[model samples]
Target chain A: MIDVFLDNGPAYLAGFRMTLALTAVAGVASLVFGTILAALRVAPLRPLRVLATGYVELLRNTPLTLVFFGMVLVAPQFGIIPPIGFWTAIICLTLYTSAFVCEALRSGINSVGVGQAEAARAIGLTFGQSLALVIFPQAVRTVIPPLINVIIALAKNTSVAAGFAVVELVATGRRLGQAIPGEAVTILGGIAILYLLFTIPAGLFATRIEQKVAFAR
Target chain B: MRTRMTRAAALGAVALLALGACASNGGGDGAADVDAGDFPEGSTMARLADAGSIKIGTKFDQPLFGLVGPNGVPEGFDVEIGKLVAGELGIDEGDIEWIETVSSVREDSIANGTVDIIVATYTINDTRKEKVSFAGPYYLAGQSLLTLKTNTDIQGVDDIGGMKICTASGSTPEQNLLENYPDAEVVPFGQYSDCLEPLRNNQVHAISTDNVILAGFAAEHDDLEVRGEQFTEEPYGIGLAKDDTDFRNFINDVLEKIFEDGRWVEAWEATAGTVLPTPEPPTIDRY
Candidate 1:
């Protein structure tokens, strides 16, 4: 088993690198777009809020695998051919995760009292200015934990791309585990540890931020 | 808080141990120690005879090769051969237990006594020979390609470079294609059946596996076809425990009879034979 790991470690690492790259790209894309959607939901315009709500509710209800399936089957019909497996998977991850991130941020926005939005408006600030300067700064600190959770979810969901032929961490582990008989238990254990190496840091970093911010009840 | 943590840890450990005690895991348990006196003298064949049934392992996914049918019974070329082996061993067909062993667990299933023999479309190779003994290279299957009916671009292996190809996960074809076509993208799926959709949708350029499996797909769908000559030689072998030399010999003898008496050709006409003609059965190598 050790020999298999030693011999195959580089391929596994290469696959892991692809997983991390996809997660990072998808994570940032989702955060930016999701934050925008969340802001739109809390905006003064009724139409913007309805659109944001619909986007989040529709995507969040669907399975991540089905979303990728649609990307392969439906996207091609639109003449939108994603160049490679990486982009296809990343695009799917971005769209699916943005919905959840939107909800998490919007929930944090709800927690901020309506009075805060009113106070900013009273100062003769536009709705956008009140959101960017007053409402968002406070809501972000509270939503950091949920944002981290979303990132963790994104990291794991990248494995679904393996079904569509993207060689990521879990897919690499699976190929190796299946090729090398009787060592599956050990190989899977190793793969699980590699996953922890990713997720544990996100968690620990969240704890540190929670401690540093120390928001009052 | 520290004392509470310690108590929870201790409680968790106890629960884990309790769960472990009840688990009959792979390569470790479930194979009972049969009384030596019950067997006919010293032969391993005695164990199968005394057990009243033999456990035969094969695949549960590959259509016409070794798939579980709509009625929940495993039907395929491998199944027919398994039945032939069971009948020759003085065991009734109903007494045979069919276990599904994927390529990964083919050797482990035999070593652990999960199966008396594996008739899965298992290829005979050097690396696997170290783990288990193979008898009667019953049939030879070659790696081939399955593509959309409209795919004129990828007629053979050479044209696959720079195109995405999907093979069954954990099988040899994935690595072989990757190594041969440095520019081609290879995807591994859990089952050969899973590769069909991606190929049909053009998410993948093609599906690659043993020709026998690809032929089944070609027969099922008018939209797919098995193209290109056999690119690689894959001799299908019957797997037996490493220690069971007598049992291995007995299987080879049965295989020879099947070939001589025309049952082998007859079995072929029924399953994978519907799509592919009967090729020469592989020579049984005692080694």
Candidate 2:
């Protein structure tokens, strides 16, 4: 197993780096977009709420593979070519994952007391100010663990990028396995280990944050 | 309870026997008549002949080579070649079970005894030889490029610098692009068919693989066309268990017979020949 990694260390590292890059970029982007969607879902205007709910439901219900297919294959028909590499993968991952992230944050926002929103309104603060300065700050604490879980899932979902010409971890393992069938098991095990390197740490971080924020309702 | 169990087992055996009989009756009307007495008593040929069935692995997606036909059985040059080999063992085409063997799993299927032989447009190479023996460089293919019919920017390999070229991952063509044309960006997919969508969308500038495979795609789609001569020689071979010298020699002998008696030409003319002109049969490498 060690020999497999040692022999092809550079290739494995390159793949590992791509996965990490994909996860980090998509993770941060989805958080921003998802938070916006969640806010919109709870916004004052019915049109904004309906739009956000429709966007979340449509993307969340669709399969990630189909989303990728649309971006890679169907997008060009509409002249929306995104250069079919890392950026394309980023677009697909962000679009698919932000919906789940939106749901998680919306649930967190709902968990906040209706009294808190009324209290913010009773004051001189407007709706946007209540959401930004008061409600969102409180909602984020409870949603951290779930949001991290979404990021972890996003890390694994990056493997889907393999089929779309983004040579990440799974694609690297497949290529190596094909080149050296004799060492396929070892190579696959090594890939599993590389994935755990990211996921396990994220899991631990989630646990730590959940405990840190363990306040009574 | 024991008597009931025994009766059930007996019924199952009878059903299987009936199915086998029906299969043989429906199979290969043009099956060759080879006498079992002509082969040595313990050879693979005699065993397969006496059993009257053979398991062969081949591609089910490659057009003009081994794509699955409308009737559910695969039809193409590879399937025809497999049928020809089975006929030599006195096995009918229907009795020859066609197992789908993708390029990546060809060696594992042979090593695990999942199939008696593989005729999946398998390429012979020194690395693969370490795991499984090969027979008959039956067809010589070469690495080439496929592009859109109206795409005038790329006429050949020289024009592909810094462009995204798609090929099957873990294939010889992928390796060729990586090693020979460092300037070209290689996008590897699981199967050659998977690259077609990307190529059509203009995500990939060209599809690079074996010339015959490219020709197969070109024949299917009006917008695609094969470009330039072959850059690397890819000798397609028959894959079987390693060190099976007798079986290897037997297959080679069968290939030599087909070449001489015009059956090889007939199989080619019926399948790949529709798209490609008939080339001289490749010389069988006995080694």
Each candidate's interface RMSD: 2.9, 2.0
Q: Estimate each model's TM-score.
A: 0.74, 0.80
List the candidate 1 regions with Cα displacement exceeding 4 Å.
Answer: A1-13, A44-51, A61-63, A73-84, A123-126, A175-217, B1-61, B68-74, B83-118, B124-133, B168-170, B189-191, B239-247
lDDT (tens digit, per residue) of candidate 2 on B150-190: 89999889999988899887676887788889999999776
DockQ of each candidate, alpha-carbon based: 0.22, 0.35
DockQ of 1: 0.22
Q: RMSD in Å for candidate 2, one decimal? A: 8.6
Candidate 1 per-residue lDDT, tens place, A80-187, comes to 777547888888999999999999998888888899999999989998899899888888889889899999989999888887667888778777766777788888
Give candidate 2 regions above 4 Å deviation: A1-3, A207-217, B1-60, B82-118, B124-134, B169-172, B239-251, B260-263
CAPRI accuracy category, model 2: acceptable
The candidate that wins on lDDT is: 2
